[model samples]
Target: MARFRLLADEHQARSPLRQLWREFARQHSAVAGLALFSAFFVLAIIAPLLTPHAPYLQNDNLLLLPPSWSELGLVQYPFGTDDLGRDMFSRFLVGTRYTFGIAVITVLGALIAGLLLGTLAGMSRGVKSSVFNHILDLALTIPSLLLAIIIVAILGPGLLNTIWAIMLALLPQFVHGVRNAIAEQLNQDYVIAYRLDGANNLQVFRRIILPNIWERLTVTATMALSTAILDIAALGFLGLGAQAPTAEWGAIIADSLDLIYVAPIGVALPGLLIFLAVLSVNLVGDGLRTAVKKRREN
Candidate 1:
């Protein structure tokens, strides 16, 4: 016991990620969040294959069936049916695709814009940085969600429209992250040495700044995805996102509001899906961040 205690103490001296996962593994919140999200993502990717019934197909007999503990007994619809008699489970499964789709595109697009603008701004001073930074500052000051609503209003409601809106709204955050990281590294000795070695500006950017900054943006991109997903759902709730019968998580919530009493899981199901999706991405992001920080420290 004494020797074991000494060894344990020595091992505990390592970085947090090494220690954190083991400690966090026992947590139901983290476990359930990861599992739920993985399952949800799989559902989204393989939606066409996994769904037992066509999500859009209507069955009057099964309309408004409550969540089934066992095959709906006689009704046979799982997790009941929506107002239009479409299977809630199947719609929810398919909706994962729509929700994740919007989130992924918006976040990825925003990452590109932020990374380019930020890299340029950070590597520069004088008027160039000022021009780019002013834009970033302007975006940062505005509320992203409100901006999304306005943009979506102009673009009109649709999956692609909401994605574009959210993508624009996400720009400021990436700019902030990218700018900070690049600014810190631009002044490093290695950067100056490379410049002195006759490396062209583009060459310097490719070799020096980007390699170091890549991890930051990667983690940021993942985190942004979570927010983007939420934003998409919000748009859906407001009827500014995926159209009806699209089975998006947010649209599901909007539809369920009218039928909350009749089929609560219609509400719960989508809500659960979104919450889990966001939570999982966040947890994984956290893990990655911790790992990165530890690497930097070491």
Candidate 2:
């Protein structure tokens, strides 16, 4: 028997292919997530072109028209009409913008805030850093929904307020994650040598640690987007999302609570779209994580 074993180049080539196959498998798990979310995104972008009727318009005569392929004139709606006779298809199309918009903006704001706070915490090791960490811990300890609800209740319901509430709620998680990543990266030999060679902390963080650990931060931020989308949808469903007549998915679900039992698809369509958006973001997060890990291994 050999004293030591050698891992050959052939084995390494096979490892990448295995990683590729695993990636493909991950992609397959996320098909439904992609399809539903893509439909909503495309619909939102082309709302004016795709909408058959104004999302806010109502025709009493056609109220509650069930989805029927044959009843073309009487019930032409594919997803059916709501109690107010608003076209389910059109509102659903229009709702995508508010929900997706909240997710994107809130997550971005939180990520930026987190980056700043986390950088400060990672660089300082004194009383101030300890105090900031405790604050982060306190924020994380509170239930996210409770925090959001409180913010909304205090500020009153509206798009801008809701975005602010969500950004505040999401900031702590980002801060904690980035802080950990930066702290770990700071321990590396390169950073140690740079510090010894007269590079200041800011220069090291800005040019060295940040660039290297950005991949990990991006992974967390992508997942955070999915969370923000869900939070916004919940707010809308609870009467805190976009105000009435704006055609938000959550607001539509809040209105159709009763009809959900009657048509099943009444509340389900918007709810399903919300679910799909979160799911798609989650899938993308998973795929990216795996890709990043594989890259690191190679």
TM-score of each: 0.85, 0.85
Query: Compared with the true structure, what per-residue lDDT tens digits does model 1 show for residues 139-184?
Result: 7888778889989989888988888899989988998998999888
Cα lDDT tens digits, model 2, 1-298, are 2423344544654574465445535666555555655775676577778877888889898878777653643445777787888888888877877888667878889999999988988888989999999988999998666788899999999888899999988888999998999989888999999999999988999889988877788789889888888888888888886788778888888888887777667688888778778888887778768777776676
Residue 194's C-alpha lDDT in candidate 2? Answer: 95
Question: What lDDT does model 2 reach?
Answer: 0.80
The 0-to-1 C-alpha lDDT of every candidate, in the order given, reads 0.81, 0.80
Candidate 2: worst-modelled 10 consecutive residues by lDDT? 1-10
Candidate 1 achieves a global lDDT of: 0.81
Name every residue pair that clashes in candidate 2: none
